[model samples]
Target: MNLFADIRALVISALDALAAEGALPDGLDTANVAVEPPRDPAHGDMATNAAMVLAKPAKAKPRDIAEALAPKLEADARIAAAEVAGPGFLNIRLASPVWQEVVARVLREGTAFGRSEMGQGQRVNVEYVSANPTGPLHVGHTRGAVFGDALASLLEYSGHEVTREYYINDGGAQVDVLARSVYNRYLEAHDLDVDWPEGTYPGDYLIAVGEALKDKVGDAYLDQPEDVWLADVRDFATDAMMDLIRADLALLGVEMDVFSSEKALYGTGKIEAAIAALDEKGLIYRGTLEPPKGKLPEDWEPREQTLFRSTDYGDDVDRPIKKSDGGWTYFAPDIAYHYDKTQRGFDQLIDVFGADHGGYVKRMKAAVAALTDGRVPLDIKLTQLVKLMQDGEQLKMSKRAGTFVTLADVVDLVGRDVTRFVMLTRKNDAPLDFDVSKALEQSKDNPVYYVQYAHARVQSVLRKAREQGIDVSEAALAGADLSGLTHPAEQALAAKLAEWPRLVEIAARTHEPHRVAFYLYELASGLHGLWNLGNTESALRFLQDDPAHSAAKIALPCAVSLVIAAGLGILGVAPAMEMR
Candidate 1:
């Protein structure tokens, strides 16, 4: 069903035939050859660069190779013409049956039409939204959550065994601060005057955890010292905050396959083992780092510390694994966490991080590279900040989550689907301005609304077809006479459908889920464009006077809905059966 791939295979066969006839040099590398949609539609339906790539390698002029190869491609039943364009580019116009077959294949495959086997069921671990479990998830974490969740779904759809993971930052000092914050709220629940201290969480979300702590052990810790109750309170508060985080993620249709705790790595041989593994590779040593380039920190001093030779694997400088105080640095646990992932037997790893963590990317990648000896590849995608606005005014902090807008607040205002879709409308590393009013509006300016409206329109056409006594089932439409679908608009729509499978493979290989969102928008626009064309052209309408003709026309919209549903499913957004 991938017309591009089929055409490329034909070009390769033609090249092999040419080489056998001694018309070209043998063993020419065609791996770089590509078949794709031509830049200008006027040129042809497809274009290939086979002749251009093989020209220098075969010691022949590109145009000579193209002219010889064109005749061989024209002999194929699917190719109407193969013209040599500009030096060596082969522009091909496909026969009408090629476009007709695209519609039929879409109907036959349904939602599985665009599914790819590029992954070959390889295991992939995607870790994201690894926020500190101190309070409800904030606006920054929401972008990572949506992006990571969508990426996991996309990999799964492309035939990878994906494990969605969240690495909880409960091992850090933040949890102790959370425990103290909860204790203050516990005192407030007991009617005692409690002063909110600096470095402690002040969000109202912790007030409930404080009250719950009071209910669980009333007056037990009222007079206890910090040493006596710090452990219990930290565990209690962390559990409560984790529960809140889970609810927040659920609001956006996100659920992790695994919740790994950084605290669990402490005192457990895991950190030592990960560092020891690097040490064996001569990557770990005790060294003093030079002053950072450009600007020096006020506290910068020469201090001996345990460092990982990250520069060996492409980092700018080796990074510290242990601070001067002899305790593990933050990077230590991260390295151990990735090592654990490697031990789990993943063929590849992807980490979705906040844009602020840009400095940590190279070191982390180096650690994984040194640990797995480059057997596994790690791709870290950084999601930039999200700016939320409403009614042309910037929204400020949320009192509930303390400093920033909580994910819950955004989900409550618009909705889960709208929030998820809007977060992905831009590239992950690019900042996004999320306007509440614009997102909720039912207009083309809003991609979520526009794409959903297209799906609903297709459903409406199908409903109308059913009511007109036409058998609009996939079996009936797939078997209809698609040769009548020869109109330019109809043929163009089918050609767009042919790009889905190839797009899926490209997106998966690049590990960019935003590409899927962009492609879905383009596909929806194509459907909408065709639907608008039918208003003035009665023959372009989905329902016709003859039942067979109506079935054939309705098949195109039905395929559109199927592909939209599949694409939205990858994004974790439910397809709209009807626009509200």
Candidate 2:
């Protein structure tokens, strides 16, 4: 049960009563009315804009409307007082039983307490970590992977049918370069001298792929030239690199539901079909793009090319779909891939890209809008770079990746849970400084540790209660006499728990999973504060003098543990049962 929503309903009922009594005009649109926590806690528990929203429509003054509505709302059993504040805002203080009931509701619902149906079962496709398959995923891709996976989980928790997908960039020259790199490694596997090419990959990770290729083909391709081996090896090497990427993702607890291939868009009529759909709407044309604003390219010359009229859909300029050579440009396959997603009957599409791809965002959205005719909404989230640091210094390049820190290296330095939680400690578009030493520290400076310690603290309390023969099962806790939970500390915790259901909807609506991480930290902070409060107060302890009082007191911590577990599950981090 959402206490905020329940209170909002009560506010709406009062507004309708005012209209019925002719204190307000008939048919006033209350859709803009909102009930939320007041800005200052000293003001009240909740605040509403019902009077301000209806004032002009009802042809009455805002404060006058608030005065009429306050008396009506104060008559309700749940509302203790409804005071008309500063203009037309109504600041409400709920009765003591209301906050006490929130605890019982949490214990009754457990982890499902904050799950929302706001999405209404819409199909959502979240595509993230579509890194080039030339090598292992780097630290930048790790942030995108964690953010996308958490977003997918948050959408699912909010009642969406989420499909986690990865788009493989295999239809480019990068795969050919990978094939040549593997060929050199294969020659080295045969104990032959080979010169390393300047542009080829030199990572040690390819050594295993090269040796595996030798095991599979034996001496069949040993004497073959580049022409004979390039095609076969390109396909073979791309597959091997994808396998390595999959294993790397698994190390971080990420598994995609779909892996769409860029190469698959070719040889199929999909590219042509997508373009034709846009062309039918007069969105495709052969035109020369103007030189980029402010600073033109050194080779900037007017050349006619096939372009998509992306400017029609709010893009800065029309983007080329075909190069001067008539071959498909880099964006052609991406257009087709998004068109395919639109045709798959998804109501919403979300792409998680790196910060460097910020320029691609407008064009991709324009293409999807032209393809779906604005029926399907597309949201592109750009995750900024991650600066990997250890002990006050930046980590060096990975020997396996040759130029960047591999995702596997980070996971090895810190376990999967630490890696996942620390990655989300910052907003996606904001740069994150991930210090390995700080992330693993068992102190409040470590957000992951601080949150997990709250869960562990509750577990320790439950274990102590169990040893004392207090029945702390969920069934017993749900029936506890929570009326005695009138301490200011206990009430403050229940207030924090009431924010979960509201926070979930806000985070899901904004497509920001980092908000969940932030909320968990705040909730953990509130929980830890209450735990410290029990030091001098005998009644504040979980183990009371009476078993009945203990049951009532333990219920609050149990609820805190349940909410923390639910939040951690959404972040793809397992909750700690006990802290070391």
Candidate 3:
């Protein structure tokens, strides 16, 4: 259950009652009313904006409204004290049992405790990691993959039916380059000398694809003309590339629910159908786009082209959908793809793209807006570049990728868990500094290790308690007399435990999963601080002289472990039971 939401509802009802009693203006809008944790602990447990939100509408001073509303809230059994503080804020502190109920609720709910129905079961499609399927995915694509997968998981947890998707750009020139590269390898497998030419892919990952092609066709196309073999090779090579891409994603624990192909859209009338939908809405036209702003190219000339009136939907300018040659532009198929998504009956759309695609965001959003007629919202998340560092120096690239590190190299070096956690330690738009040496270090400075270490410590405590014949299972702990958890140190942990359900809602509303990582870190810190307290004060220990007290004290640590396991589950990290 969301305690913050529960308290907010109570505060809203209390204000409405005051309005009914004519203590305030009639029909005052309470939508702006909010209940949040007080900035200063001295203020109280939760603070409300009842007076601040109603001051202007009620034509009364904020403090006067707060003073008038205080007693109404104080009448509830949940609020022990509701005092007006600092110019109209009402800080309310409840009795210890009020928080005790929060702990019991969490234990009963388990990992589903923080799951929210905020999305109201809306449908969402997340398109991500649509890397050029020309070779094995590199390190940059790895970040995008993890970010998209985590975001999809977060949305699912927040009560949205999510579809994870990847758009294959098989219609582009990059696939032709891949085809040529595989052809060279095919010749090599046939005992013929071949040289990878300029602008051709030279990655070793494609060598197997060529050998397989040779096996299937028995060298029938070995000496064929370009036109005769280009299409076939392109199709064959793109399929192989996708196979490699899928395996690469599997290695990193990513799975896409759908894989849409651009080439498939070409002959299927899907592109025309999507464009016709836009045309019906009067969003399509034939026009010459103005030369790119600020610096016109020397060869620039106005040319008539099929354009989408993107500016009508918030883009800087209309974008071209058909080239002057009458062939579809790169963006035409994308608009079609998104229109296809809209037709699928999704309620929302999210695209996870690299930083270089910042210019593409506006047009994509405009397309979705026009496609769904503003009924479905589109949110684009851009993942910034990750600078790979080793011993404070930039890691050098390999000849295979020309100037970039491969994803396999990274996974092999740090393993997938460390790589995933460290990548998510920052906001998506913020650059992540992944220092190789630091990520591998098992110290407090490493957040992954620090959080995992706290979990391991809790496990150690539980093992110690069990070895002494103390019952520590959920059944036994659920029946513990938590009243013995009266020590301030133990109570502090219980308070921290109360924040999870609230934090999940906040993070989900903001569409920011990194907030969960930050919350988990703070929770880990609080647990570790309480553990240190036990060393200095014997009474603070979980194992008490009285078995009844021992069970009660152990409940606090047990509760902490449950929340940690849940948080780690969301992060896709394994919670260590012991540090090795």
Candidate numbers, best lDDT first, in rank order: 2, 1, 3
On the 0 to 100 scale, the lDDT of residue 182 in model 1 is: 94
Worst 10 residues of 3 by lDDT: 483-492
Per-residue CA lDDT of model 3 for 1-580, tens digit only, reads: 7777888888888888888998887888888898888888767888999899899989999999999889988898989899998899999887677666666666667667788888899999999999988888877788888888878888888888999999998989999898888888888889999887788887777778889999989879878887878888888999998998898888788889999989889999999999999999998888887787775687688888888999999999999988888899999899889989988999989999999999999999999998887998999999999988989998867555665788877887898878888878999999988888999898878888888888898899899888888988866777766655666656666767777888877777677788777877888888888888988988888787887778777777777878888877777777889998
Please write out the lDDT profile of model 2 over residues 206-272, one tens digit for every residue: 9999999999888778879899899989999999999999999999899999999999999899999
Checking candidate 2 for backbone clashes, the offending pairs are none
Native-to-model Cα distance after best TM-score fit, residue 5 in candidate 2, in Å: 1.4
What TM-score should be assigned to candidate 1? Answer: 0.98
lDDT of 1 at 422: 91
Pairs that collide, model 1: none
After superposition, the stretches of candidate 2 with alpha carbons farther than 4 Å from their true spots are 295-298
Tens digit per residue, CA lDDT, model 1, 1-580: 6778999999999999999999998888889999999999889899999988988989899999999999999999999999998988999999999988999999998999989888999999999998989889999899999999988988998889999999989998889988999999999999999888777788899888999999999999997898888989999999998999999999998989999999999999999999999989988888998988875688577889899999999999999988777899999999999999999999999999999999988999999999999999999999998999999998878979768899999999999999999999999999999999999998878899989999999888888888888888888889999988898888888888898899888888888888888988888888888888889999998888998888888988888888989999999999998987
Worst 10 residues of 2 by lDDT: 292-301
lDDT against the true structure, each candidate: 0.91, 0.92, 0.84
How far does residue 107 in candidate 1 sit from its true spot (Å)? 0.7
TM-score of each: 0.98, 0.98, 0.96
